[model samples]
Target: MPRSPYMHLPPAARSRTVTAVLGPTNTGKTHLAIERMLAHKSGLIGLPLRLLAREVYGRIEERAGTDAVALITGEEKIIPKAPRYWVSTVEAMPLDLETDFVAIDEVQLAGDLDRGHVFTDRLLNLRGQSETLLLGAATVRPLLEKLLPGLNVVTRPRMSVLTYAGSKKVSRLPPRSAIVAFSADEVYGIAELIRRQRGGAAVVLGSLSPRTRNAQVELFQNGDVEHLVATDAIGMGLNLDVDHVAFAGNRKYDGYQYRQLTAAEMGQIAGRAGRHTRDGTFGVTGRVDPLDDELVEQIENHHFNSLKVLQWRNSRLDFASSASLRASLDVVPREDGLARAPIGDDINALEHLLRDSGISTMAKGPKAVELLWDVCQVPDYRKIAPANHAELLSTIYTHLMQDGAIADDWFTRQLAFADRADGDIDTLANRIAHIRTWTYVANRPDWLADPAHWQGVTRGIEDKLSDALHDRLTKRFVDRRTSVLMRRLRENAMLEAEITSSGDVLVEGQHIGNLLGFRFAPDAAAEGPDGKTVRAAAQKALATEIE
Candidate 1:
């Protein structure tokens, strides 16, 4: 038998009481982990998504107070003096931080092709001083046990029933439903249809800035929108008041290829439907075919095939030189059920930079090589192309190595390009992505000459862009007059009406038409169902006022 890669686990770490809280979504596993972390004097928790990390940070802050909690993600960092609790994205979690308790959500992601290596590394190497909790689906149980001996495993039942409601059209999905799609184009298309048919839908995509995503979610949660159009981003523990999940498309491009979602992946997203003790349903919509009976049974039962192997990468890098660094990263794992991950964005960026003779010469020593590796980790948020992203990375690396830090003027110029708030929805979203790249740069310690000042400047710009993007999305996909009237009608609330002296009729502060004597004329633009909706609402309100 081959020796284990985790043989380096210290005696203390090996002895810590590590618990695996395995369950489907809405089983309150995250809630339990948070409670456990708060019980300790100091603790750290790593979540799968920056959005989830932000959500958890807010919850922890509300309980532990702002001064005691710190939030760290690639693009955002908020650390307070003498912080007792730390919340971070899995990629951003500081493994060196010594805490009494440590918890990692979505442990099953260790099998993910792209990001699994990081999760696998955390699973094996990161341990709390006293207690550690691994929270994820029950499918991870077999793998967790094989990896960690003497692991305490607890399974929780779903709090509510998950049923298969079969297929439904986008226009027919229930209120408070979330229509899940795999691509931005699909999401936008569905949202547009819902706006035409069901008033509007809040949009949530992995690409949206956390601020914008949250604002969009608010539109649904607060009843401004009757439905939500989102990608599988909602799968990563976003607690929403959703009663059903309609899959507009099941297949997704998982970094490498467009493939059907595994039963586990489907369960994760479908599981987002119900919250707490409320029941939920899942089904197909749009152009996708209906799920097979067996697959539907598996999802409804929350049963999934156990992960056979986990993606692993050599975290202990040589960094002596670029060549040594690449060699070390390619090292195979000795442990069973562990496979080397394919080249990721960071490694690709490194290879691209190494191709440049100037960069190769500068990245000579261990310090320089390590800095190069760190620079490679900057994510390609813009997604323009690999070459374009590599060019940006090269510029940043050259600036960092030539000067002690990136030149303020150059950084400011890059930021200035994305600072403008004028753009259509796609344009604004693109600008938000551009600003996010600079935000990540600003968050990197020592990357900028004045990290604190740049952090503030970049964050302000991101917030501004996020707000602009949100407004653009709402304007493009939402009809506020229709949504307000429909919601009011649903609630059986009496509508307010006013008539101007010039005979203009208004309902709920929205101009419906002109009242000429006994005739109520709707606006020329109101046609189809919209015209009927306006007439119905107008008649209800005017009956009380005109009489």
Candidate 2:
């Protein structure tokens, strides 16, 4: 193995108080971290997902005031002058900024394949001046102790129990349940089935913009929908009032290959079922096989194998040239239980750029090579193909090297194509992803000539597309009449009934059926259980008016 690039660096002093709070999901580790952070005069917290960052940012802003809080993510930046608290995604954290307190959420992601290296780098290097907190699953406890000898470790017990409930059909699943699938297609299929049989389901996927996702989640939270269909994105720190979690698909493609979820992975998702002191359950749905007895037991008990290693990559890159940078990345870790991560999208894009003779020629000196590496770090949000993504980076790097910034006309053209709000769910989702790429570019300070102006433009387009997508989803999967009637029925409240001049009977402003000559007829579209629900609600509400 090659000598470690960091071996030559002098040892640095440790933080005053570096604490690792380890536990399973719903253990309130993240909440505790935030409380500790807010207690300090100045602090920073790095979350694993943009959604989580935004959530925490809002929480912090509520206490610290928006003027005292700053949010920094790859695609979104909200910085007030001299902000005292910084909430950012782990990868976007300003490690160089010193604060009295700092915290990193989901620290166990250091074992992840695609982005583990980033988490590991932050774990090893980033530190607060007076106190530092590392929050994640209990699986990382041993690794934390081994890696940082003097580090303090605290284990938190789950606030509520998680039990396995066995298998059920999608239609038979209970209310306030989240059905988990591994892919977008599976999530949509499950959601559609739930919508037909159980009123409707709110959809959640990793691809959704924050605005769109929050809207969908609101539907479920507000009781407009009884179920939520989502990918593994919910396994993160998304707090939902889910009483049960049903796995629609047990297998997922983990960047490299398709495989069954590990026991710990299942626990992370299943654990999201209940919040606070409320117990929750997990089980299989659809054609998925029931989890084995031992696996089920382990998940319920929050017992699983601890992580043995963390993915590592050299962050101290030698930007003198592309070759040197690559070489630095290949340097082996000097510590035990640290393995080099496989080539990620950034590396793949860099390799593609290096193969291009013209691009390689232009990427010569330290500054140019560093810039090339920076451009390569742009995420492949549109997962069309690796070469296509690399081609985009090439255009960006070439423009920066030649003209100092991306041309406004060219950038505007890209944004214009994705600006339209008209499209189906899939089309609108794709447009959101496309616009997200430009949004990420706009956030880069030096990439655009007018970063602030372009950022606002991209954000506005994304919000419009997100709203359109939300509307499309709601129209397709949600039966408005059914959801409204069901919610009112459950509340045991009198429904608002109205009959139009044309003899159309509407319950809560949702057309239920037509009334003619003292006889009521349900709409043709209202059939099955939903139709029955509407009929029952209409009769109860219109009894006095009809009499």
lDDT against true structure, model 2: 0.90
List runs of model 1 lying over 4 Å from the truth. Answer: 1-15
lDDT of 1 by residue, 1-547 (tens): 4332233574335535689999999999999989999999999999999999999999999999999999999999999989999999999998668888999899999999999999988888887778889999998888888878777899999999999999888888889999999999999999999888877889999999999999999999999988999999999999899999999998899888999889999999999988899999999995789999999999999999999999999999998888899899989998888899998999989988999999999998999999999999999999999889999999999998999899999988999999999978888889888988998999999998789999899899889989999998999889887888888888899898899999998888988899999889998877766677788898898897778
Give the least accurate 10-residue stretch of model 2, judged by summed lDDT: 2-11
Query: What TM-score would candidate 2 get against the native?
Result: 0.96
lDDT of 2 by residue, 418-505 (tens): 9898978999999999999999999999998899999999999999999999999998888777888888998999888999999999
lDDT of each: 0.90, 0.90
Error of 2 at 17 (Å): 2.0
How does candidate 1 score on lDDT? 0.90
